[model samples]
Target: MLRGQRLGCLSIRKGGSVDTHVEAVLAELAALEDPRMRQVNERHGDDHGVNLTKLRGVAKARGTDHDLALRLWATDDTAARLVAILISRPKSFEASELDSMIREARAVKVHDWLVNYVVKKGPHAEELRVAWLDDPDPVVASAGWALTADVVAKRPELVDLPGLLRTIDAEMKAAPDREQWEMNSTLAAIGIHHPALRPQAIEIGERLEVLKDYPTPPGCTSPFAPIWIGEIVRRQSAG
Candidate 1:
């Protein structure tokens, strides 16, 4: 029998062990950490080296257990927290639940993963996105931008394109690093998806010089909005 362990406001029991299931998963994750992957992950500042494909397998084996997820998140292990996000119920975060997680989301991977795995799919996603846009916390604000960008990409007509363009024009260079990436991508999305705004987006791209000099990877479209838009426009014209 394993010893009892409980996070505030939540409890678990498995084979007479408190959170034993969570512990079991953690043990598995600890064994899977690869040194090379750890080195790469550390460079990215995420502090976890477990292969993602294997991690998913772990979640699959354990099945969906929000109780385990929450307890794993409460621990300090980076990989465990990632697994927590992976295993947790997609829309189970209650009011203020996200706020608590955001506080500890110091790593970029953690911030991005939580947003992708939890926040964007939740009922409060749109509300939280708009509200978090102006939040003081960089991570929250970054997440807000990311969520908005994704929505804008898929459904440009629903967002205030002009306002977003304005922000991209005015603040992207000065915004936080993650926020800049999101804003840049949003500008590209506008150019790619909204023909009427393509010129404006390209112009903004020119002014910002965002990715102007970025070396495009072989066979990959350049991330620079102007170049990316030009290529797409050329392809469309040819077609």
Candidate 2:
């Protein structure tokens, strides 16, 4: 059990028994628990954890604590779940399990980690992603777009740039906030990697004006697609 505002007193170890590793990780996280973070995490509906930075340190220690990670995820502790995503072996998951995780996920962090770290890197990423695009679940759909954005950025050869460009043009404004964000990224990726589609991407950005009104912190790129796409294209050109 967790001590008041402290992580559970479990003892985890790198390369140790899974039980030991889980315990040690929990104990370490418990020691680093921050009350202020818990208040913020609660807003995400059941994220149970300390700060992500500390959880990452725990994952680095284990590197690939598959069994330990599974056990941790079952605990529903926010920090433990994040560690689970980091250390779980991609090959160990079945397709059904991946779908189940998305359906069960209640926090955006879980959705992000599953898409960015787990599914996007899985062997069936493309296969799974294709179907996710049409999934009725918003989390799954958002993840599809997110995974697509990654594919568009790193493996453009695998994507149908023209088709995705059309999809972005059609669905972006009506999409949910998270899905719209990833959709914008897809637009940016298309602009950065596909020369023929770059102008079209810019046109889409101009039309949507998504994130145009959002404030940009000093020294940070604007999240607005027109601005974001411009910076990405500028970097690609400079290189």
Q: CA RMSD for every model? A: 5.6, 6.9
Write the residue-wise lDDT of candidate 2 on 22-127 in tens digits: 6777789898887787787877654554777777887898899777776787666667778889999987776666776666566788778887788876786887
**Pairs with backbone N, CA or C atoms under 3 Å apart (clashes), candidate 1:** none
lDDT of 2 at 7: 27
**With candidate 1 superimposed using the best TM-score fit, by how many Å does residue 200's alpha carbon deviate from the native?**
0.7
Give model 1 RMSD, 1 decimal.
5.6
Q: Residues 39-148, candidate 1: write the lDDT tens digits.
A: 99898788988998998898787678887788888775788888888888878876367766765787778788888889877886777777777888766688778888
Question: Global lDDT for candidate 2?
Answer: 0.77
Deviation (Å) of 232 in candidate 1? 5.5
What is the TM-score of each predicted model, taking all chains together? 0.85, 0.83
